[model samples]
Target: MTPPDLSRRALIAAGVAAAAFGPVRSAAGTEPGPIPQDRPVRIAMILYPGMTALDVVGPQALLAGLAPGSLYCVSEAEGPVASDTGLSLVATHAFAACPPDLDVLFVPGGDGTPAQMRDAALLAFLRDRAARATWVTSVCTGSLILGAAGLLRGYRATSHWCVRDAVLPLLGATPVAERVVFDRNRVTGAGISAGLDLALALAARLRGPDYARTAQLVAEYAPEPPFQAGTPAQADPAIVRAADAILAPLVAGATAAARS
Candidate 1:
């Protein structure tokens, strides 16, 4: 029997339908079937004032593609959450409205991390969600927030270089100075730009390396920075000193917050 020829519009509609009800194929040649609608992977990202915009946005760009309609920006109250640089990202869900069980619980680091560390409600939310989350993750200083929530006790984590060694110990977490550190389902990324790498790793874990590689290819994530000064080790002494000066206040506040 011959199949009927379809118009371009019909073909486009079919493609959209396939995307909506597509099977998540694994690299091992698993049979195609629709993902269980009732058990979609739920991702919750915490947003707070003074957070680094890139910390969350970088990871979200990749993670959003992994599961459409699953990623959520959550906060104490749903509204525009302001970042350190005055950029605001809207929180679609409030802490109370977010799902009880999450596949991924993510937080972003920023100058406001110290304040968030001291926020009892936010800490409680993190603690609760992390208790059942498959992955408790953070980018940069977000690890500090997780530690404050008592979620990172005895866990090896990473954070922004400025506070990695200074504050994590105070919160009972072993800090590693790396781009991304994963210790038993707790994944932490160091600094703002590392969020992309961290999300890619999580994507690979959740889906497969093939999916992550395809995402990377789609994003053209090849990096050729104009300068080799992304890290303190690679930067000039004067530049490193300047950067430290800018971060001194945040480091001091986070350290104090960790202790208290």
Candidate 2:
């Protein structure tokens, strides 16, 4: 199914109209706005073992309210999926059960990404769904998965700062050093925390700035990082070295997998 062309000007006009005259509600009192279009926007987020928790949850939290009853957490099976941080989340649907045509198909990165890049089933699912998805997105190392699936070739994308330079080139994608990179329908976020930014940007694109702002306010999405070490450039040289050293093994494995 073809997704609607939600242009920025149209969304802005809609937001302005709603603010000026309030939302046009039916007798049932439902806010039948852009979200409740011909069909709800189908959003599917992939889950796997040893994946990062915050990477998925952060975006989910922001986008959930925007499209209620349209978000899905899918994996190979419908059961508890373990994360890199020892936390487990339940997958509501298996990959096979997910809708074939998705408006947004998202993948999150974590310790399991290197292994997931090699999983034929997961990669095949991503490849198939990405072909039909209106927006294919990833957070952190998840962009590597999209790259490995042959989806990001020739696309300017970003990933976790550590492995992006080493891995994206192997998949023929240009590595970009930024918090978020949008190349057509493919949107990628750097590191784990950047998911929030990616989601907000997507929210604005899908609904409007006013809708995104409402969701942000509901989420209390204010940020005030106490430390200036979110990135290598912001942190001390020694700290950057230490972080690189700790992630060396994972990066090496991912590099080797990407090359293979």
Candidate 3:
């Protein structure tokens, strides 16, 4: 079956419906006013070798529409960063070139994060930018890196369920097993695909619910998984065991790295 052609232009055109709507009240008990169209919202997404592409790109795909030419894919150096799946994505900017202050700062996670947790340069960059960014966010194991950078300490956050509990406590963070968790300016999403939820929730906070709803509509963001097995709690016990076995090595490595 041919999938729907939910293109960028289609999403932007559909987003116009939001202009007619009033302000949106967010879960934080605040009403977010319309974002100024005159100024672009600066966003920097960190990239590293072995990072999960979807963890970054899923959110980027939606947030990029919020402000075109404002989303920057950055790394420690300018080059192609390879994902865990062996796909390579180009970093448009280096850490030195990234703006010191940003409207949003994002980090993604994968096999690379255990190493990144110990990377002084990468941790420093996150620390510096997150200090001034209006929003700090992560997807999947990305929150683990944030925790290692001392950003998530004392804050309630979430991550890929496999390591969510093991790592957050290492940085004095309160771990929550949820799809998304928001505490003040810090937002985190669980697993790889939860980036979509994180981005839409952030869009509602940054722009308005109307705009977010439009973006959701454009993306056809509804999900109906064929199997009720996305979560360990919901999956068959045997399947869950298999998954745990597969992830045990990575989880162990992450836990050891976090403690170290």
Candidate 4:
């Protein structure tokens, strides 16, 4: 089945697109329990320098609501990391310092992602946790990190259109250009802000479709952007070139960062 596709603009215009919806804590009547309460939903978002805040923080926000107090900001460092936009974000845990058990692991992307893609230490962190994690996910170019770790070797995944070309060949991943893509245990979101789509999908899968629907209602995920085009094939050629021009340096920076 063809998964739904959405652009970052669509997400912003909606403000989730709905207003009256309430917060969703846990999926009612759907709990993957029988495990210890000490674990606390265990979602660790990996942080890096020059990353897009939306790619990491947006989904984390939604997930944060669902699992309050459990959402943690883990990093490969001990201090604040510089974002793609030059914002410094404080990290809670370093890659090597995180706990042994993580229920979910999410990686976000941005101008720093390509550099993160080739980071052996980061890849090892993912690989080590992936062996025991309940779910593994990535946002935007973050999927390339998963591919670099060899987790998406045969899966159809999604990433930001600007970076899909780079991610496609690295790990034999069938890179699908979509808002969100899921292949069993691995879930990925597209563009800078598509993390919400991926998170809602995970919410549905982890709990139930109703949980996702409820979240959609709460997040107001119904409205589409004023821009008629969501997919590149459906967009005007000029728009593509314009966006490409904007990302060229960031892409180059990511490349240089990764190699250095």
Candidate 5:
């Protein structure tokens, strides 16, 4: 039985697990399914302040929802990580203290971008850890941190739309303005919500299209944002104008700071 005290967050995690994995039912709903992953994937996610919850939560949730395997949180220090939303997450391990068994390493970003950008030690840790992993991925301005670590030089990537231009040049990357960009072993997702799309896509890439499609069905992956402003292309001219005006300086300043 699901725990009574389990928050909606936990429930969502459980639901996603039901999606990507579980007994495989064929698309025609008439044949037995094959195993998706051949081996367990060890994932270590960095938890930092101001980090967008969805950025980490979406992927972490996806992995957690998968068959029981190894997933742990890492940080500069072990303890609780406070998010931009004011929610605190408990870290299971420290950066330099991580085990040598990590298969995937991920980081999420936020307004904390400015501070994390200046963290040379954290950047170094990311550089070292990512070098060993099978793949390294980021959400939102997490790309900023990776670029800061010098891992993204010559890589084509994407990030939250507002931060793409600022972050791309910092790493010598060509910014792809799409919601997700996969360049060889490095995968990046734009903004916060795009993390789920990227993760699902990664699953499809790694586990095969059928497995990914199963996950999408289980999670009801169709998007239906109630607001028209979900994308600049879909928003009114005035709203887009106001948003650009409000965000321009912040992007410009961040770009300048990271370049220096």
Candidate 6:
């Protein structure tokens, strides 16, 4: 699907009409004129059962500006794919239909990650596509799936904090605790919300800093969370214990999947 042009120029041009329609203001710009589009980038986001909604959505919302029609949501089959939260996103292309060469190949992490790790067809698809893809990336537990495909071997990567240290070694990946870990062309984001940071970093690599900054400005990506519970270090001991308890099953399942 072609996303609407939400660029700085577009927003400024629509200011009058947008003001009439709602309380929204035109996006503020950090650069003069429009952000230059170097080239059309080809991106493929994998869709599978039980993936996290924000894992893909956050990145895609920002990166879609780099590639409009070329941004493909692909799956084993073409249709609606359900996430862990029961949200459904359409997979516009099937495995066979996705292009061999891609500027970006993105995978999301979620509850179904264990099953995806064990899917031979899915693993094969990733390994095949990653060979030619310029950037291979994952958010949260999606790094486990990439590792299962034998894609992260000898690569420094990161994932959801719960499995970053424990399970990554099983798949031959050295896990780091950073929000976004970049080992050459393989970019892995820590946990879910990190996708936003990863996408902007990638935008700078793909286009330029000015372009990414403009995209960030247009989206107003400045974040101010109300709580300090985002990471284990920041969270209270009680909260960390509860969160660990919740993720225990997933860790076990992913560990088992990686070993097998």
Whole-model lDDT values for every prediction? 0.82, 0.82, 0.83, 0.71, 0.72, 0.85
lDDT of 5 by residue, 176-259 (tens): 988888776678889889998888876665445655666666667799888978777889999988988876764765686587
Quality of model 3 by C-alpha lDDT: 0.83
Which of candidates 4 and 5 is the stronger one according to TM-score? 5
lDDT (tens digit, per residue) of candidate 1 on 22-100: 2233333232222343334567999999999999888887777544566789999999999999999999999999987
| lDDT per residue (tens digit) for residues 16-120 in model 4 | 222222122233333232223222356789889888888877787556544445567888787898898998888988887786566688989887777777788
Residue 2 in model 6: shift from native, Å?
26
Report the candidate with higher lDDT, 1 versus 6: 6
Give Cα distance to truth, residue 116, candidate 3, Å. 0.6
- Local lDDT at 234 for model 5: 86
Error of 1 at 162 (Å): 0.4
- lDDT by residue for model 6 over 1-260, one digit each (tens)? 44445565552232121111111111332111222243466789999999999999999888877775678999999999999999999999999999877778999999999999999999999999887677889999999999999999999999999999999999999999999988877899999999999999888887667667878888899999999999999999999999999999889999999988
Model 6 vs truth, CA RMSD: 9.3
Higher TM-score: candidate 3 or 5? Answer: 3
Provide the lowest-lDDT 10-residue window in model 2: 15-24
- The digit string of per-residue lDDT tens for model 2 on 53-122 reads 9999999877765444657899999999999999998999999999777778999999998899999999
Displacement of the residue 93 alpha carbon in candidate 2, Å: 0.8
* Candidate 6, residue 59: lDDT: 95
Task: Give per-model TM-scores.
Answer: 0.86, 0.85, 0.88, 0.78, 0.80, 0.87
Regarding TM-score, does 2 or 6 come out ahead? 6
Model 1 poorest 10 in a row by lDDT: 10-19
**lDDT string, candidate 3, 206-236, tens digits:** 7667767777887889999989999988999
